[model samples]
Target: MTQAASSAADRRALLRLARQRLRARVRRPNAGDAITLALPAVLVAGALWSGSAASVPELATRGDAAALGMLLAAAVAFLSYGMLFRAADDPFLRRLGVESRAVYAERAARLLAAGLALVVVLAAYAARAGRIPDQLLPIALVAVLTAWGSGAAATTLAGRAMVTRSPGSGWGCLTVGMWDREVAAAAPLVYAPLIPLLSGGAAGAAAFGTGWPGVGVSLAVALVLARLGARWWEAAIPRFGPQLLEMAFAPPPPAGVGELSVGRGLARLLPRAAAAVWARDGVVTARRFAWATRIVWPVAIVTLALLARRGTDPGTRGWVALAALSVWMLQMVALVGLGRYERGGRRWLDRSLGITPLQRVLGRWAFGWGASLWLGVPLALAWGWWTDAGPGWPWVFVGAGTAAVGAIASVTAAGWR
Candidate 1:
């Protein structure tokens, strides 16, 4: 085939793959998935619709515009990084004879397209809110350029972290000696463009009293980052591509001390059959990095409590904190409940064990409930004491009930699989 024909064919193949993946995701919606997806859309839609003509002028001020640009850039960086690093399609694509650079390009193109679409929506909203056309143009341009730059930087960082096998370096340490050291390092460089974008936006607001200066700065940053990421991707693929594949197919790492002890110690406190199942799930939690990272949720809950305390009356503050904690508990049903099953050979082992469905359900429920209380109890008490409210001990029962529901849902889902 001619070079041109080959290039066209590759484009068609990638597009087909993208379409199929999108279709599969669309077809597999469950109640939890629908709610999880809808909540974000609802929040964004609510924000957009809540503002009025009266608020538009103040909202379109330079500082607010700059903050908006920074916020968009930050969101793009985080989403792109997570999507690129956690994806498991590298090995599958490699097997299909897809070039690594082409795979990265395809993914980056999709992200850039999504970013541009978001820019258009925001710009339209600004125009509808009576912002001057001149101001809207520059703000839109800056947003598009910033998103492009942020996505490229994130992709490059994710790629580098994926290829890194040394546990002592970068975020490889997060692997905690389990699985491939695939966690992207929380490197500040991935977000370096935010500084320039923010500065440019502020400078544009000050100098031109418009967003024009930001457009040029954003474009330059985007071009440089894109070119650099492209070069690094091409060079790294030949050297580390095989290693990347090996990492994907690698067996689960040996259990650490925490995994062993946590399960066994918890088992001692439960009934015999349920204890066995609970111990197993507990070990699974330890092995999964998702659970460890969820520590952030509790931290966020505390931060919200502290922030609430500043302005509100003690009664209101206490209620607000309690409400936030309750929401967190409810969310745990989806986050922890659905993730109880093991994958691959271990899944087969689970089936082969002479454990009854009732025992499995009871065991998993106990595990989830225990996990919830372990995190939630301390948080509730701290909030109560700090706010001079009475002990929030009743939440323990509420947490247990929610956790049991999550456990049932998870086990039922696993059975279907």
Candidate 2:
């Protein structure tokens, strides 16, 4: 790029930043934003404080730290969620006649500090009044972590916006405006999957019969996952919107049968799957929601693996894999819904314009199967390796077959009323 072009791009970015800040300051505040931003934190906090009061006493008498540990764990989760919940900077900040960045920065810091001080005072008094609760450690840790996440949400947004304005060749715009909504929407669901694991994780694992030892091993594995995941989330959060957008707008491969090479660095993407994976479905399957669904499988498989480690024999683990069909079935349904949006709702609208459903289900299964494995193959291999279950054996056959069947159900549902 020439010096003129580089200077123009920089100028555009700075102007855009300034314009956004101005708009945020001038925009009117509304009740909905306030409700949306604060409600989850309130509910989580209420659950942590009230639920712990009752459970902690019972567990305290028995010296069972698990109950308290669980409560604290929950408290921390709510706290973390609250922290990560990105509240839109009030557009009305400019109305207060203190709109410049320097002033805004100073004010934001002071407000955050004051809020923390007030919370600390209130919490200390509440604990004292409640007779000095026995298990506040977890609750406190979780709450602090949550606040940190919340505090960083804006910084994350700013960093993301900066990246957007300077997207190098082929990189697209990732404006704070567009992603601010998407991340805000998706953030709530992050805890949705985990909540099931927290409360029902044991029951799900017990389906394998490894007992607490199984659960322990599952957690040990999850911690490592959590660390890796945290690192990935930090990198992905900023550019995810633009990257996701590009994935959507980029033209898909032709329906050709030959001369395709995925060459991204995965054994599963070997010619066998790649050749069969049609470009259209391949791109659809390769997108965000599809990958998210694929990731969900590990969460499920890990729970089952814990059971296997505890006492779920290899055969029983296979059985658990079969039962996993239910989750796959449901997730494929989600994919179908996402697929509609991904395709810009053209197909659905066409159907509405009087296109009839063809009876034969020929490509439906293949589409779902290809897509499921498109996401699942790597996951299955990872599962096999992690559980020491002899790689390439079950993952290659049983896992693939099960995923295929589930995709069939999901695609089939697309045709139904």
Candidate 3:
């Protein structure tokens, strides 16, 4: 019991240290740094606001208004966190637990694991309990993107706070109510979004007892519940709090240490081994970590669903343009592939040739395009399904072909370099 108590005390001491470090990093910013961080957000908001101003559509009813309002709120919270995090550059949050080098490689891996779990849980919940929106496919898309955005907010805030922060002083956004510091950082825009979301939610809950008055009231209540629920989702910073979700599980065995020997048959695949090696890592480095890729098709699918539901006349040219751009963005992962390989390149290189700059460049393209095709094929199929263009496999084949074209174009251009 004495030993256990001592351990607990040590843990608390360590956490406090990390928290102090994070706070310090957030403090003491220079004027230039402050302005540089602030500018991009201002430009984004101005552009979006300007767009909204140009066409003030009547909020079809209370529900439309609620979602639109929440979107703005989500946007503000996201943007402010981004600005603050960028300025923070705090890495002090890491406490003196695990060795630093192992922690770095595992961070990405651990995040991916958590995200996969989160996605599976949320989908199961939605499938079982929630009344997904009528524009469900698109709604799913938006939800996916929103989840990614939520992550962006968390990382930016925690990462920037890194300078003064200990290695692991992560953010628990549910604790945001206490963070008047961050919430107040971008007041002009922040307030605009948050007020409507919060107050409207409070108002909606009061009306939930309205008892099936109409579809309108049902959705309004749902919005209110969502807003309240979101407020409670404070993530536990792994290193500081309970330490449940470390970026990695057990540290991977080091080079020349515990590698599994491949049998003779598996050795034949060696030529293609480099491609196989980086597949998952490459997709991950490409922002699939945020589940941003999942958002694209769901949005496209939802949009297509809505269009079909309304029986709207579709323009072929518009769709072709949309398809081309969608494929392009999906393929952007190729450019970022090198980053993942480089992160853990030492271990990979032991069994292979060392990565020359050119090989690194080529490998990145290969991984990016390979994963893009993985995503793009389905998106194209869904488009065909929705539009009734042809049978499913043909569209899938077409998408695969188009994505190949994009891969070649991307890798060939100086852009991938």
lDDT on C-alpha atoms for all candidate structures = 0.58, 0.40, 0.39
Ranking by TM-score: 1, 3, 2
Tens-place lDDT digits, model 3, residues 211-239:
23433443444344333322222221333
The ten-residue window of minimal lDDT in model 1 covers 180-189
lDDT for residue 119 in candidate 3, whole number 0-100: 34
For TM-score, candidate 1 versus 3, the one ahead is: 1
lDDT of 2 at 93: 29
lDDT per residue as tens, model 1, 233-255:
66656545576556435356555
Q: How many backbone clashes can be found in candidate 2?
A: 6
TM-score of each: 0.64, 0.33, 0.36
Q: Taking the tens digit of each residue's C-alpha lDDT, what string does model 2 give over 192-237?
A: 3244224322322232323345444434443443333334344644
* Of candidates 3 and 1, the better by lDDT: 1
Error of model 2, residue 120, in angstroms:
22
Positional deviation of 272 in candidate 1, in angstroms? 5.2
Give me the runs in candidate 2 sitting further than 4 Å from their true place.
Answer: 1-248, 251-283, 287-334, 339-345, 348-366, 369-417
Q: At residue 18, give the lDDT of candidate 2.
A: 56
